[model samples]
Target chain A: MSIVRRLGLTFGLPIILLAAWWFASANSTDFFFPPLSEILTALKDEWFGPRLLADVVPSVLRLLAGYAVAVVVAVTLGVVIGTSRTVRATLEPVLEFFRAIPPPVLVPIFLLLFGIGDGMKIIVIAFGCMWPILLNTVEGVRAVDSVLSDTARTYRITGTARLRTLVLPAASPQIYAGLRQGLSVAIILMVISELFAASNGLGFAVVQAQRSFAIAETWAGMLMLGLLGFLLAMLFKLVENRQLAWYHGLRRAQRSS
Target chain B: MLDVRGIKKVYEGKGRTVEAVRDLTFTVDQGEMVCIVGPSGSGKTTLLKIMSGLLDPTAGEVLIEGKKVDGPPPGMAVVFQEYGRSLFPWMTVRENVELPLKQKKLPNARRKELVDESLSAVGLAEAHTAYPWQLSGGMQQRVAIARAVAYEPQVLLMDEPFAAVDAQTRADLEDLIRDIWHRFQVTTLFVTHDIDEAVYLGQRVLILSSSPTVVRQDLAIDLPDERDQLNTRSSPRFAELRAQVYSQIHRPKADAAEPVGAGATAVDGGASGYGAAPDLP
Candidate 1:
């Protein structure tokens, strides 16, 4: 389909749903179903107000910190494990066990150990997101073309140059996939950690609003969280595009002919 | 410029040991282009890898400019057959060519000049900013050659570099290598299974026996240096040289050196009427 029609098809359903919700909920008296207009007002006042400073900012910061930690640890460990057979074989089983456990299940353990502070929450988020990045990076590194490795050796590209120019770029496509997967996992763990025990954060605000029966405020918090996730994803995609422009170009050229 | 002294390679396969190369010894003088041709399983790659220090021989050693080669020697570059796998797909043409220059610690200005010079030599000046996968098969191979040439190695090793491309592209690449070889005055050891290519592109053609390989013949190519796709290949001397190389590659081997193991598929070809192996002395 043409790009314009494709865009229309993509956005058409969401626009229609928003229009229906606005019209249907315009005059509703239901306690649970607040009017869309009232929801928007609450979103502006609550999300765009001091609450954003007190909640959303901290939450975003925690997510970024945790995600950054996961990336660093996973990439470093992945390269080590991927390149060395002995290391991989030794740690494979234990790493698998850790990866198999769901991130949410570790929340209580972290809460007990770190005591419900930002430290505990950030650790939980990092632990949850690290597995995919680690495994994918290992896969990418192991899958690096043998010929390219030989080329590096022949060129005498030793030390940091070997890692920076040859190994990293060669495995970057798989690494990017891992990063995207880790982002979603980080976001999930972010909310779960905050929801269990947290004074501030979007998740905690939503839970607090629901408990206090401020339904419109709860909707606003949910709306803000959804938008945050969407924006973060879009931002990740932009970075991916910039970092992997050559990879995408190659894929597109391959697809075209 | 390069010497391989009594090299032997024994691969320890699962539950068996296979001798790939045996007592292979040869030399290529400075500024000479030599091609090694053999039957499919004759261990040409093993020999090249050993010579380039990518692999160690079970016995013997290689010397480049009289220096013992235990690792990739400083003044050598190799162009492998699998261009798809050899060139970094993520890097642009310029970056791929520039990689080794950077490794060599050339200043940025000098590296840029060499990259540009080599790319244009390979007719890829317009493609410096393009990725390998964005180019055609032949173009990718050109990038590989440009990379090797850009590094300005004293000895260039190419292992069946044109075996993957179509016939037409292969011809263009053969000429490209010849042009670069002449322009740079670099000693080249090119490996190929194609008899015509071996005869057409080399100053000397080294023929190897089948498995447990040994050098069977080292024939000087007496063709004029100025060669073209039409005239050089169609020359009477070209036909005779190709057939002679063809028969040596196909000659029956002793029972002990029988073609075997992984490269067995390439054992049988050139069965059509060709000259018999030159009277063995």
Candidate 2:
């Protein structure tokens, strides 16, 4: 498909809906349901200049830091637990107990423990994202093909070489599945964590607008959050396609054949 | 050189005990191609696994170059039947072939030469950049062969490597194996269920029995070294030798007392002795 057609297919409905809102709300007088034009103007006036650096940059950095820590910690622990039957058996119930508890509940506890700062929010984000990637990595490592394992063994591909060549790549597709799930979860928890006792962030800005009754600014903040989510999702898809090109191609070939 | 001495394997499950391989013994000397053929469920795979050090035997051991094989000795390489699963899908053909050499810690120049030579030897130099899944079944199997060949091991083990490909591809791969064996002079121990494949590939064919699996007949294939799919397979000698192996596979253990006929296993019409007759006076 051509780039124009693909873009039209993707954005056509959203554009139409935005246009409808633009025309429909042109003369809106309700405080909560402000005009789209007013919201756009409010978005630029409130967030486009000073807040972009002070609020948005810091929020994005914290999200990424938490996400990176979660990925590294989870994958490391998952490979260990998955590769060994004893470790998996020993930790499975404990992990299950922890995983059953809702992630949001930890935020207030984290607040009490770490106090209101970047540390608490980062921990909350990491804790929320850890479950999916960790479990998927464990599952993926466990499900590495027996033939491939045997081939690795017979070739004397041991230690780091075996892990690098066989274990990681073999389990990567499933790992990516977990990673993808964790990303949206991380985004959600980032906002949720920011909502409580956060002095600066996109979430803080939105809640702040709501508290002071700046209705159009509040709507504009929500729009920015949605736009941020969409852009981040697109960025994630580009990385995944690059990292797992071979996997996608392999599946496509298998499916067609 | 490889020696499989008195290998026995028994599976102790939750409810039952099953004997997979019982007192199996064989030897494949350096630069020799020996094929092991057995009936279905005869533990051919179990024996290969034991020899390759991928699995442990209840008794006995495998020795390569006089060193015992306990944990997949560095001197050995295996070409598995499931080519799709054996070759890493994430890596291109060149990467798959170069992986073992990386383990061996060879220099980049040496590694590249080995990978290039092996790929071309298997008629797959052009497909070096292609991933295993991008190729046909036969081509995938060729990549597996190239990987094994690049390892430059003393003993090469193949467990029905051509079983997944079509007949024509099977024939072509069989020739490829022979060519590699001739070129590299790597000691190859092949295990297969196909009788004709066994007869065609090996200098010596070992027929294995079912149940408590044991060697039934250690027949010697007396065809010319420069054999082809058409000429050698159509030869009378190949037919006679193939028939002997076929009957031996079907024969039960209870009728083991009768000695094989004078011309049963080798049927050497060309020479007096060609390494087939073991109990000759």
Candidate 3:
């Protein structure tokens, strides 16, 4: 019975939200406050109609490029730092200090260093996406069972072979967790970067519409960004599910116990 | 053959020092199986760790075939008490068994053959592709055993390898170890706290005194080489040996009123024999 109610809640909650918004905005006087229906119409007619693919493609490409770079750099460094006690000890404070600083706050510095371009935005996104991945990778590698390490040593598995065969696989669940978190941050920073400085992308489109007081168009752009974030998060979940099927099974078993 | 002489281990921490084992000595002849038993914290594990070259004794040396064991020797393999962690979860059972063979740089074909044979020897042929987490505790321990055997080491060291399993499984594993030891003729040094397990599986049992341990008694099992779990354990000889080892381990020290028997006298006569029984208050 609880399961059935949960299912209803999952399906019904969103509809209720849309209904409430639609009713509230039905009699609004402010031009900035567009109805949900108006926003949807603008989204369908302008955002997803003829120029749909072109507007979304560049933003997605930038996000992917930044995300890929973040994953590679963060994972490599994270593994190194995690595997060596001395390295971890030397670098952990620096990493924590950097992680505490918000990436958006670096926009002015990045603009100064790299200039106002896609390069700046990419750098920002990469920087934003890196911390979660790096921290999680370190944790994952450290959390690898000591007994497995002993077994590997007993087999005389050392150096690259040990890292490749034992450490990587053992640390994958945590690494994947890091990747998911990093990807989410990447999406957030991608929009944030574009909103702050970029000439193109969804953030630029939203800002442009808002300056002209094209409220519906502004809402449509915001809606698209929200949808993109949701979609990317869902995509990450799919990847995580496929990659961490065994981890999920183990979790289920643990929960049952 | 493996020889450990005057092995002493002292652990110093937080301004306090623990003498885990002191002046312990023992030897395992080629193809002979020996079991070391003592109370918890009596350094049974520390002794095994030193023997396997996982730890260096604070004083003394472990020699395998007359060569000093400074690090994990290629000729010796170890099975730990925690079966769940010993076998790599990411690798299939066959892969786990074959890993050492790979390290030995054996040909792929020979590695495959050894893995198959070892898995079958441990009754895990069908479980070759199963991950360690997919199997029962006993089966996982069997994979660990299979891994050790597949390495084809000259000596196998087990530290309470069956302690995590159920009674039925523990008995089965004890028999399995004996069978494998006999079949392969590999020198095996098994350490356990269970007296019955030590007597059941060992050609000779070396009982150690408590902390700062030393050998209390070295009892040779008179049981036949060929053993069945039921028949051997049910025999009168098995009971006598078990009782003998039990008494040696549990004898009260302050109550010196009882006239010391030959066995008691042997344990008490020499500082070398009884040393200091584990510091069990």
lDDT (tens digit, per residue) of candidate 2 on A1-257:
99999999998999999999999999999888999999999889877767788788888888999999999999999999999999999999999999998899998899999999999999999999999999999999999999999999988888888899999988999899999999899989988999999999988988998999999989988888888888888998899899899999999998999
CA deviation > 4 Å runs, candidate 2 = B256-281
Candidate 1 per-residue C-alpha lDDT over A142-163 given as tens digits, one digit per residue, 9 for 90 to 100 = 9988888998999998889989
The best candidate in terms of DockQ: 2
Clashing pairs in 1: none
Candidate 1: where are CA atoms >4 Å away? Answer: A1-7, A24-27, B255-281
lDDT of 2 by residue, B1-281 (tens): 56666789999998999999887766676688889999989899999888888889999877776677788888888999999999999999999999989888899999999999999999997998998999999999999999999999888889989888999999999999999999999988899999999999999998788857877767888899998999999999999888889888777566644424333544321133223223322
Which run of 10 residues does model 2 chain B get worst, by summed lDDT? B268-277
Superior by lDDT: candidate 1 or candidate 3: 1
lDDT of 3 at A174: 89
- In model 2, residue pairs whose N, Cα or C atoms come closer than 3 Å (at least 3 residues apart or on different chains), thus clashing, are none
lDDT of 1 by residue, B100-174 (tens): 998888999999999999999999989988889988999999999999999989999999999999999999999
Q: What lDDT does candidate 1 reach at residue B152?
A: 87
Off by over 4 Å in 3: A1-10, A19-30, A49-53, A255-257, B252-281
Each prediction's number of clashing residue pairs: 0, 0, 3
lDDT of 3 by residue, A37-155 (tens): 89989999878965466567778888999999999999899899998999999998898899999999998899999998889989999999999999999998898888788777767
State the lDDT of candidate 3 residue by residue for B128-238, as single tens digits: 777677788899899999889989889999999999899999988998998899889898989999999999998888887777677777778879988888899999999
